[model samples]
Target: MNLDPPISSSEVTLERLDPLSAAAARPVTTGAALLALVLPPLTLLSRGHEVTQPLWLIVSYAALGGAAWLLLDRSRSTRPVWTAPSAQVFQVLLMVMLVTAAAATAGANDLVRDDWAPLVVGVLLVASTPYRPAREILFWTIVHTLLCAALGVIQAPSAITDVPALTLAVTGSFSIAVMGFAAAAYARSLTSSTQLWHDRAWQSAAAAALEHRSGVARSVQQRRVSLLNREVVPYLQRVVNADGIGDDDREEARRLARSIRTLLVSDVEKTWAQLMLDDLVGRHPRLNITAVADDPDDLGRRAVLERRTLLRALAAISVERLSATGLALRLSTPEGRLAVRWEVATPRPLPDAHRELRSMLELIRGLTLRSSVHELPGRLVIEFEYGY
Candidate 1:
């Protein structure tokens, strides 16, 4: 439950906690994107006569198209979690389209009450709530809201209006403020719900572990059996089914036996992370997995269980994916921060492997303090630094 790099006043990502909410938002996002594509241009067509500068309107709709494309693009579809960089980009693009749309009639007309910019921005923000933290959404909302008012003021100089510029500004930004606040509130609600669910789940698990220790032991044994079934049992069954043992069978048998040996024998002093890597080494013994631990515990402050989930993901991509390659894992505690350094030697790196690696890491980037990926000659290096 003690996750590092926590979201604003929340346990972690809304996407991680309430994936159903995140998945549900996508259809709404697509709808909003289509609105962006359809609504503004139609509004411009009706009010096209009052335009002082036609070029600005053209630029505005072009930016609108960009924002729509940003939403529709499936480049990041493979990633399991929401990514901040892309979401922030979408916000920026949206603002650009809105501001330019405002600029089309900057000094000649009253700010259009039916401005699609602010409305679409708000709707999109709501759609993004499940993917982004409330604090981040609110920050961008406030900034854009101010810009909305500023647009009103800029247009008020020559445009005939019954109300004061301040009133106009406030009135102009009313929809944005309302919708932005709504999105932020929804985001907070999602975070709270996800946190409560996690706390309850963890408490139930703890109570069960304490009250029924034997059940927990049996569950662990079942998992161990499942692990053997994936590799060892398959090779054994193949040997029994085949006419005789070939060189390939013998090599596979040796590998599976090494995995069993590695699982059965464990150093009491080693951390769970170390044991995990040992298991990986057993599975892929051809990879000369050299591991060195500076301090016994990976994170001296957090519980071993707290760090396992993230580290397991780290190990999967960094160590488990490669085969017959020399890998080195270095775990050190520098300045009370957990720093993990891993390098897997792949003599011939696959095409676009770096992109695939980066996309994979994006799923866990929210959990770690910082991460860096370097594709060196004959090796792929990844480093993760965790905070308390």
Candidate 2:
């Protein structure tokens, strides 16, 4: 019999978490929320005599970018304020950065210059939408950088920039710098997202592999049991019949054949039991071996009884290769005058019994588990007197 492992509970839980779902559900961080506290005032600073120089404007925008980055990085931490209210505030601050950056680039210095506000607001709106926000962020970042490009294109159709007061070289250099920052941020987001997907994929693949191995193990056990029942026992029965016997010895020969069949069944059962134990341990390599109970009875009343019923019933059912699920067993302990009921839960609910033959067969199987299958809200429940 082949022995493998089962999937771990942690693996199952991780599959349920669904990284794509989390990423989709997560909120987007906007430029407005993060830069609101810093950039609006910077606009005022730019309006007054203090911030007229293009170099100073560049430095101001760079500082705003740095501050937004800091807030975003800090938000990633497992802090309480990273949840909602704080997140909203941070988004607003980022929006301010977007507005200020756009105005600074457009060379519109009015204190309440609403002309470029639409462009700034548009960038923020795109940045704040969830589901592939990285892509959206990248798009807006490039759009802003392209605005700088368009400005340069307008100036330098003949050369580079027409602003003789400022070097075209300087404009070109800053434009490159803006585009570089956008590219870098987009690359970072893509890298982070790819790594996240890889991690989840690896985990899911490992879980699927474990499940496959478990199936293989169960299949091997079933096949081994089948060989003993269908081939080995029948072959021995034939052998016993072939041994020529007088009429007086015929009964003895039949009894001896039955004994051999019993021995074969015992051997198969032992092999199956070993395979199950091996899988239980193999699947959970880290499970404390010393703590695991060998006897099914030691697993507690519910577990032990269920395990016993499952093993015996499975062994019997395997001979027939039954496809049934949701089996219920009702046990009657006549000596104690106690009745118990139980049913099996399966992924797919079994059909209702219509024929007497089918019902009798099901009843016989339930007698093995001391339980029976209830059709609706399908379950197998075993009910019995506690003392029994």
Candidate 3:
């Protein structure tokens, strides 16, 4: 078997858009969206403090809601194209705005800030893990940490003087950064492992198929060698052993030469249509198998296999159920499509002939782009159209 052509860049991109990866990434995005939705309200309720700047708090909640909506919208898309770098940058900017808003809300009110917004920002970073590179993740994580810290310093300068408050701001932002890095690392590792397994499985299957084909070729070669020894070699040996040339020996030699010529010609590759007709006529000596073709060499390997399978099924039906003594195969290529028409004559209709034909036709339908089976009073016709 020949190896397929090298994959194009577009093909590689399409493969990267695996539905499994999209499915796995969706849950992470959805979870981040949910956290974004739930965490701010929880923080407000727990703090039990009046929001001095209600409008800023509203803006903060609106930003968080917008981020959540964006992520949820991307998750809904089949391919999840939001994992691109530009999209990630836009999302991270939104997260930064949300953090700044939260810090402003803390500054306006004398509330003990819990750093929930920064933590949620860290969680939102996981949404890009499936598509973005590790360096990109690391870069965004550092950017987010610095942005959160700067917002904290600007919004709550008094709180920064207290040791515990200072510790909370620094540690909280760095801890979130650590979590983001860990999530990105894990996602990358999982993707690598899954791809590795898929490649190994494909290679294993290809090797097994190649081995099976080699075995079949060896078997065919052995049979051909045995046939030559039995039919041609012995006659030649007898002629050589004889003391003198005779008319009888010459006649025998002529017959042997014809046999060898026929064998050699038959060994040449023939179109599937020709091969099937020869095989069917040989198996059923009384049966008439006619094959007509135009440009049979244009047929692809897959088309040939499909034609052979259909012929085998028809042959089996003729042998087992219908006493069909005649069959015709017409193969033609028109407008880049390969079309095959098969006609078989039935002497008398069997009780289950139509049912069996329908079943066989149904199986053949999968092998071709278009196929149809028709039954007349005493004949069945199958037409198949396929592409290279």
Strongest candidate by TM-score = 1
| Candidate 2 lDDT trough over 10 residues, lowest sum | 8-17
Superposed by TM-score, candidate 3 places the C-alpha of residue 275 at a distance from the truth, in angstroms, of 17
Where model 1 places Cα greater than 4 Å from the true spot, the runs are: 1-13, 71-76, 80-88, 108-111, 160-163, 208-388
- Count of clashes, each model: 0, 43, 0
TM-score of each model, in listed order: 0.59, 0.29, 0.48
lDDT of 3 by residue, 1-388 (tens): 1112332322222114243455456676787779867887787786546455677777777777776676665444322234455457556656655565655555443433465666667676676555445556666777777766566555555453354545545754775577778866765665566557756865776676468557645654665788679966887788689888899888877887787677667546555455545545656667554433333563533453334455656666765566666666676666656676877777766336666565455444433435666676677777776522
Question: What's the best-to-worst order under lDDT?
Answer: 1, 3, 2
For residues 1-388, write the lDDT of model 2, one tens digit per residue: 0011322221121112232332232244544445433544555554444233555456545545554554444322111112234434444544454444443544432222222223333333333333123443454455544444444443343431235423432443353334345544554454456557756876776676568658965766675677568755765677688766566466655675686577557545543334444444344455332111123222222233333334444423422233233333343334433343444443333443222124333333322213332444643233333221
Clashes of 1: 0
lDDT agreement with native, every candidate: 0.66, 0.40, 0.58
How many pairs of residues collide in model 3?
Answer: 0
- Kindly report which residue stretches of model 2 are placed more than 4 angstroms away from their true locations once superposed: 1-32, 36-38, 45-140, 149-388
Better of 1 and 3 by lDDT: 1
Ranked by TM-score from best down, the candidates are 1, 3, 2
Question: Which model scores highest in lDDT?
Answer: 1
